[model samples]
Target: MPTGLVALLDDVAAIAKVAAASLDDIGVAAARAGTKSAGVVIDDAAVTPQYVTGFHPSRELPMIWKIAKGSFKNKLIFLLPAAVLLGQFAPFLIPIILILGGLFLCYEAAEKVLEWLHVDETTKHDEPAIVEGHGREEEMVSGAIRTDLILSAEIMAIALSEITDEVWWQQGIILAVIGIVITVGVYGAVALIVKMDDVGLHLATENEGVVAAFGRGLVAFMPKLLTTLSIVGTLAMAWVGGGLLVHNIAAVGWHGPEHLIEIISHPLLGLFPESAEMTVGGIAFALLSGILGVLVGAGIAPLVHRFFPHGAEANE
Candidate 1:
């Protein structure tokens, strides 16, 4: 009986070790997946601060928290299950769906550009009665969540594609980890960004020495920073969208864009020294891809506006 009990304990220990190892694997996979989704992650972080622009300082963190929760729900509740189901049953559909999502990103970026250029003919009418306080906050939160849903979906999909040959449960666990980590990271950074000027102001008023100067500098830099973030966000959307389309097209069969990028990138290889060739090539390729994304988005914007005439001029 004692020997049997010892054997049982040994079995338990083995199982425990296996479970711990699996947890470790999940952590590693989650981190790797999050890293793979860097572009979308960066875009998500960049785009989010815009929603807090008009809000009172007190409202910023709460709104961000709400959006972060929504982003978590988007990934863990909606996209994760759907992705698993799709991976299990309809793996073939992944690329098509991703391509469609990419096109939507492109369209959004293009619309913004057209609006900025004053070339878009869509007109906007102000809301009937302006919402106040809680209602306005709700609207902003909802809009931010809606945008986050798309970005989260793309992030989850990108993460999903990075995973290979894992069992469904493992994939799910990894995805959950990634979703939580990314949501926290992106929104946490955004919360910091939106409150930076406040922090600066506090420091400037309450502190002394170089800290005050630094605080004043931060205050001076914030508007430009916001503007830069907006531009970067738009460009990131286009670059990511274009990359997805190009890579997926190559995955299916056509390699035209891929080949073109490589060809365009090739000249940079010679211009830079050997060590920087890859970096230069990558930059060249990204630039070309971003341009392609912009062109594709611009081309499709008119069609989208024509078909969806109702809210064409709506600010994204």
Candidate 2:
């Protein structure tokens, strides 16, 4: 009986080892693949702040909670299945969809710029109307979900492209990981950001010297921080959105932009030293892509707003 038990233990140990290895593989692949979606992920985090900016202090946390839940639904429930289906049924369609998403991002960013400068001569739309009444919460929640769908779709597509070596199950799991990780990270940061002022006020009133000083500083800094974040988010949206469209355009058979980038790189390569040259090329192309993307976005914004006022122009 003792000998038999020892053998069984050894067998269990071997199986456990295999299971652990498989899990490690999944973790590594997920991390690698998710990192590729960095651009969209940055844009997502940046854009999310605008959604939570206008609510009352008491309602802010609840509002963020509502949007965060909606974001999860967008990613896991809707996008995960759709991403798998796209990987299976119409692999070719993915690029097309991503390109369109990229365009939308660009348009949204450009519109934000236009609004900030008050160039369009429209009323203040940087903030959406607050829904009130019995149905108001539901309306706000639904609107958040609708907004999240667009952002989540962009995130998933970028993540999907990131998973180069995975089969369907592998890709699906990586995307799920990315979605959950990013959603939690974004909302968690947002919650902390929104509440800082309150936290600061409480601290400032406290008897403790250090805490009070920090609180005072936070109260002074909150507005500046939010303003900076808004600026960064808009710029990120333009650059990422433009980058996605340009890359996808090449993938879908337009060699013009890609070729032009290469040609531009060659000149920089001759002008710069070895290691720095590569970085120069990349930065230049990214700038080129961003500038072109803004132009493209500006051009398409009017048509899009006319046809689908809620498209990228949801403004909320």
**lDDT, residue 140, model 2:** 61
Q: Which residues of candidate 1, in runs, are more than 4 Å off?
A: 1-17, 112-131, 206-211, 270-280, 309-315
lDDT tens readout by residue for model 1, 140-198: 88988988888888888877877746779988888888889889989999998999999
Give the root-mean-square deviation of each candidate in angstroms.
Answer: 3.4, 3.0
Query: Which residue ranges in model 2 land beyond 4 Å of their true spot?
Result: 1-22, 126-134, 208-210, 310-313
Candidate 1: count of backbone clashes, pairs at least 3 residues apart or interchain = 0
Candidate with the greatest TM-score versus the true structure: 2
TM match of model 2 to true structure:
0.86
Tens-place lDDT digits, model 2, residues 23-62: 7888987787676566666666666656655556778788
lDDT, model 2, position 204 = 94
TM-score of each: 0.85, 0.86
